[model samples]
Target chain A: MKKSGSAGEPRPLSLEEIAKTKGSTESETWELRLYVAGQTPRSVTAFANLKKICEEHLAGRYNIEVVDLVKHPQLAAGDQILAIPTLVRKLPQPLRKIVGDLRDTERALVGLQLRPTGTEVRE
Target chain B: MCLPNLGAESRMTKAVKNKSQEKRSLPKSLTGIQGLDEITGGGFPRGRPTLVCGSAGAGKTLLAMEFLVRGAMDYGEPGVFMAFEETAPELTQNARSLGFDLDELVKEKKIAIDFVRIERSEIDETGDYDLEGLFIRLGAAIDVIGAQRVVLDTIENLFAGLQNQGILRAELRRLFRWLKDRGVTAVITAERGEGALTRHGLEEYVSDCVILLDHRVTDQVSTRRLRVVKYRGTAHGTNEYPFLIDEDGFSVLPVTSLGLQHEVSEERISSGIPRLDTMLGGEGFYRGTTILISGTAGTGKTSMSAHFVDAACRRGERCLYFSFEESQGQLIRNMRSIGLNLDQWVKKNLLQFHSSRATFYGLEMHLAIIHKIVQEFQPKIVVLDPIGSLIQAGNKRDAHTMLIRLIDFLKQRQVTAFLTNLTSGGDALEKTDVDISSIVDSWLFVRDIELGGERNRALYVLKSRGTAHSNQLREFLLTPHGVDLLDVYVGPEGVLTGSSRLSQEEREKAADLIRQQEAERKDRELGRKREALEARISALRKEFEVEQAEAQAADGEEKKRERALAESRTAMARSRKADAADTRKVLKKR
Candidate 1:
């Protein structure tokens, strides 16, 4: 039912990784790097928030590599990062991105068109 | 798709990119309409639940039924109808008049109609459980009949029954996964929210595809519409569409409705009227062609159709005649005078006439009856005597769709169809009765002409799909012998018009009177000259007669004088005087 492009080389990497990874990988795995500014209260909160959420939501299926923008400004431009806190869900389908501290799960769910309720996630 | 740093500038770009992405993977489906499937690239994704949310009475149920019935009947895919509202008996009865024998379909095991009665008080969700119970039933039925379609009448019922949004939304999410995993195309109906796609805001929940049906009253004219709100992963039509629900069930008409999908025949077949056929081309209307005859009232449209049926009957091809204006007996008897005896055809089982009053019923009923006959008779040629009468059954657009379905249905069977419409005006209106001209392969326009001081009936081939036709308007006359296309009435007046013919007759009478006066004058002059010459000759004869009489008297006197002179001369020499008198008398006689 998911009519993935009948034409076109099945793009194995995200657009950024495709540009950076070049020949280093052949696994066809989506590697995502969520960039943040400094380990300020906002950046710490965003990292802790994304770690637990990814484990509970995506469940060990994805890898969320957090990058600190204050440490490496060059990496900010590499991923085209402008905000301090951003969560990028790069995956098997359309790679989606959400910026800011992941406080509102409703917004994140809508952005991804993900079913909001897990068997235990419902309040 | 490019994204700048998440600045305000990038934020604006993200919105644009979001719209563009939404446009890319649009979810499209057949809607099962003729030109529409091509537009949507072959229907919605199967088994992926499509949300059909609309305002009140927007034809959501009608559309869902149409899709399911079309699949079951046309596509041979049995369907399952799960209605949270409306009982099985009610749905059957509601659609029964539309010729949808849901009851019969259920009996045939071709379709399963289930009423999911949800009682809120009964919901003792003391234990954590998904609505997998309902899903299991639907799945079982689909597996039982190999049903390909699943319709949930109103999705709002779920929210209405379950007060806990957390539990309800969770089950809603699970339902999509369950249906998609099962791989059966599903259409779930929902009531529209005040402004959002659905009242429960479920547009984002189960929307692998989304279709919105709307009923709008613009300028006091209500138009029911259907729109593919959003369908992911398919290229779909984005325009709001108008649909109709009549007896034939729900029929959706695509925005750009006309396209040549089937191969049209270049070969023309006989319309049974030799005159009309010859004018159309050497042959006649093709066996499976749709012919439209349109004109004003009393223009022999019915008679022409009757002639065609009579001809078909003679040739041993069955014909179905549907008359919206007159009774069957009236049609038969009226046509009898014009040499079309339907009674004979009836006996032969070659002609069937169905006559009904359009105003006596509804549009859906008319379509149902038409569809029913098309299914039953299986005639070689079908004639809708005057489609104009059926326009009264519904608004103009409904009539168009019904006629389209009818035409498509007939053409599939290769049955030639003839429809007549009484166009509104005499001024050569730029528009037709209902754009019936679009669906028909051939258009026959019969018009009344005013020329030569006489009213004449003329028939012409406005358009014949693929043949060399005579564009000349032939004099069409209805008589006891049948309809005839008279030869060209060539004259200085050119083709004789109604008033021109009458005027020519009037002018000819005046010319005859003038010629008569000129001939009488010539005869009188010849007689007068002859009489004058005879009178002059008579006068001259009288003069000659008088002269002759005097000459005779002088001769008599001279002879007497000569005798006396002879007697005197004999007596003596004194006869010299008598000799001189005699000589004088001789000179007078000479």
Candidate 2:
């Protein structure tokens, strides 16, 4: 899949490549925008789950940008957010949006085309 | 640094005067209604695009115009109305009927109303163009009139006329930003979508606030409800509040104030139909209260409403009767048989009849007419006979908006109203009866029962807001004398179903018991009569036996005569057989 963000702006990196990119990273490269509206329960859950996922999955390689419409409504223009609780792959080519809470790991993994957690070494 | 202390106190005093009529603890807003700024906390988010999306005929344009006109009148702020669809003359005329006097306002340099005419087929776009022309004209108008409020009578047309999808989208984004920057409260009327709240998708992720207007009918009762779907950085009433549009202007009825807090009366007045009043409890509903009488077809819905109007006139209260089902004369003639004399009320101007067919037009057009009449007449009570008839014209929801507005208009004036609705089945005791029960405070159900080979008209109070109404269903009769409320008939088997089956069962059971008792008495009496007859038969038998014995004893002389005759014959036979004695006997016999 073609990603839109800076680290993978030209092409989506495979799990093995992502692991190598993490090894060769100079600074936090990925810029992600979790677009949400207010402190509604679903939005809050999505925000919390996204932060945890970024911390666990990308470690210090990604910079998570939380764009709350409650604070800055104008930021909804970045990735053309429509419904609330949208997770946008901003730094990846062919920007993708996954709506609803990010707690559904299987759907998120498929949407972002992330490699299975323990199978990265096999690739 | 601001330093204005001189006229501020007097301004506060004027504001206090305006505050008396407002609902308690309302946020600082104008609420976009005429004479309503004193009620809302403040005008709706100033300079931000407020989306007014509801089902059709929901008083959206009227509300927007009210905001503009009220801004010009109450606050002396100039207003500009830019309609993308209607002509300036038509828009002005529409406002005029509501006492806006747009032409006069234009002369006073207080309002600039323009209808931006755009031909969709003739327009072509080659490159991205800034809508600076519209902005420049709007800016010039604002400068000329110092306009504070602006309304775009539906932004959907702008998208319709311009073919440059990319530019239009960008321009719309720019347009909303410009309105915000200009700091003038902008109302953008958007057509509702078949699926979405707004068709153009602009209402998605609104900038500031979104108020949805819904017009709907439940069980034939139409109601228009205004609901604040989204309001950023503010708290608003989430429920859909009822509203009205008329010659004066559109007014949103704050349904939450239907408590002891508002002015009300405890005095009961007849519903013009005595039967209806008793259903409301004892005499009837209190004056200045809304009454809804609903029932299925042929249940006397119109007659009951006519009867109510007749009673109101007799009580010296002016009433306006709005019949959407039948003509005035037709209504009068039909109700005459039920004893409701509306001619006298019409003569005294106590009752004014307004009848029009429901298919005349859409719900908005009907609401507009209703608003005009209520504004002109200002009657003490208003009546909408068979509100459901309008549903045949459009969706149930559209009919509802017109209803809410009508009810709201009367309630705001403190004029009591009697609305009639025709239900599906003529069942008065339904589990959830009367569709408009939510909008109305009181509900009366009228029905007819086939009782004992005769039909009985009955009425009962389903619900009455803020009143101690009886749950008892009272018997009612309509005759040439007028509407009479009959006393409650408590029969042995409880409140009888309006059917002949109950009486038939009683009759059948009584007949059966009577026949059983008569049969048993006949059985006992016949048994005694048979014993006497048996004894008489035994005596006759004994008498017959004694007669037989006497006959036997008396048979001796008759037997001896017979034997002598036989001996003579035998002697003759012997003579015929050729003996000398026999020959003589044969000659004697010959």
Candidate 3:
């Protein structure tokens, strides 16, 4: 895991690194950033659910960066963040956003494009 | 979280302390918009959110932006504009057309702008969340500028950006509470919904004040109106005021705000024509009174107005003439034909002419523009020539209301208004289309009196309040020298005018000449009769003298014979003394 120690600091993977990794497998390195207002229970749960999903889908090809807007409020304007506990997928061709806590793992995987949306596996 | 909670509690305490001092009336933050403060009884509620809801292109965003700009510039209150739709540069460019320099204000740090763009395609829903990030950003903006005013332009975009309705609703309520706790006045704009005040029912949240703007097109004429749906803790004007959005920004026209409280003036002014003045109680229309001159087409309505304007300008007083049917140059040239030089007054800045087509704008816009110009010019006399054209530009009811408001405004300033109306030939000459005759202080009716194969213009004072005006009809003559009012010829055949009057006058002159000749002949005949009587007397005298002579001669002859006899007898009587003495005594007696 690549970590950004400071709160509200966004560390995006270089495009060259992503492009170089794209030839080896059909899937590339997944770059995710979790935005939160403060250290809330919902954000902690969303971060844990994200980690589990990334490990099960592609073990060593994902990067997660946590951003706390309460520390640097001006950063919210860059991502147009209104709701807390928001997760942004930045490395993909098209950027995506997921708002709320990751309490529903299957729905969270579908939202992050880790699993197919139509298929549902019963617990 | 604990520190923010403590700060909110302290702010709440400070607000509570201010409430005591403001117990008598609700403290209001002035919006500085023209005519809006009057209708709102000052402005929006202080430290509270006001909901401004309208449909698309209804000027909601512009109104909110104006509120902020005016607050910062006029009221010395810094504002923060949180825009959900437009960026700062886009907003600045749009406001620049209305004479607002938003960029300068932002540079001066008098205003803070934050654009929140939410794209639904890019946003996804995972689980539970709140809008705390928005709160932090807003708080930071407010703190940076020390803003006293806040504007959330179309805050309903949050409903589209987020998926959780329950959390969004709860968080919106908390946000409003937080804004209030921060002790700043706020304006929130929302889109109008079908059968609801706002699309997201935001009115349920911001209950202090609600203003609705509407743009409607009727008969191909669009008018923008603003109505304060509800204003708590104060009495506000309930009428829907017509507002204008032009290069000068928003201006609301409160029609019925000015009641019948204008001070009346007993001083009368001249009507330009001496005969017309004589018809109007030997003085003229009352100062600061409305005069309506109603007539059919080509009845000298414009000529009469021109005469009035000339008279006012001749008095060295300012005059403003609004001509809806004729251009300024055309009116000037036409008035010149009647011996009235209006261009000189225009050059001298004593007379101003505002000429435009009646259909160029809606009735409300016309009224608003008139108000603006009147305020700027501040003329003593105002003349609206042929108000009939303006009346036809709008519906009858709207035209009447606008006139009432206009008259009230002019009267309040002690400005005399001279309005001309063109009535249709088929309708009664006494009736006007707008039906404003009853409210006018004086009414002049001009009509075409067809007589002896000719049509003549006749004018009479139909009504003059507080003046004993003449009831006689005078023939209106548009002479090259000027307007002339002649005493109509009243004869056994009724009122005579034009060629028939001239003919009647000529016949009377001929009859007078014949009567004078007859009197002279009678005098001559009397003189001849007297001379003949005198001559006859003299001749008679001569004839009597001749007769006397003849008689005397005859008598003399007899006397001679008798004397001879007497002489002979006297000689005989000499012998006889008695006869001689008697003859001598007779001679002595002779």
Candidate 1: tens digits of C-alpha lDDT, residues B466-493: 7788888777888898888775455776
The reply for model 3, stretches above 4 Å from the true place, is: A1-31, A54-65, A116-123, B1-23, B545-567, B576-590
Provide all candidates' interface root-mean-square deviations.
22.0, 16.4, 4.4
Docking class of 2: incorrect
Task: Sort the predicted structures by DockQ, highest score first.
Answer: 3, 1, 2
TM-score of chain B of 2: 0.55
Q: What's the C-alpha lDDT at position A6 in model 3?
A: 19
lDDT for each residue of candidate 2 in B193-290, tens digit (9 for 90 to 100): 88878886765455477778888774454656676777665444444455666556776644332222236677777776644554555577766777
How does the DockQ of candidate 1 come out? Answer: 0.01
* Model 2 / residue A45 / CA error / Å: 53
**TM-score sort, best first:** 3, 1, 2
- Candidate 3, residues B238-314: lDDT per residue as tens digits? 66788888898888876557656679998989999999898888999899999999898899999999999999999
Better of 1 and 3 by DockQ: 3
Q: Summarize candidate 2's per-residue lDDT along A1-123 as a digit string, tens digits.
A: 111223223344566776664454435366677766666777778778777767766777787777766566444433434345667665543355565577666556545444434334222
Best model number under TM-score: 3
Q: What TM-score number comes out for model 1?
A: 0.52
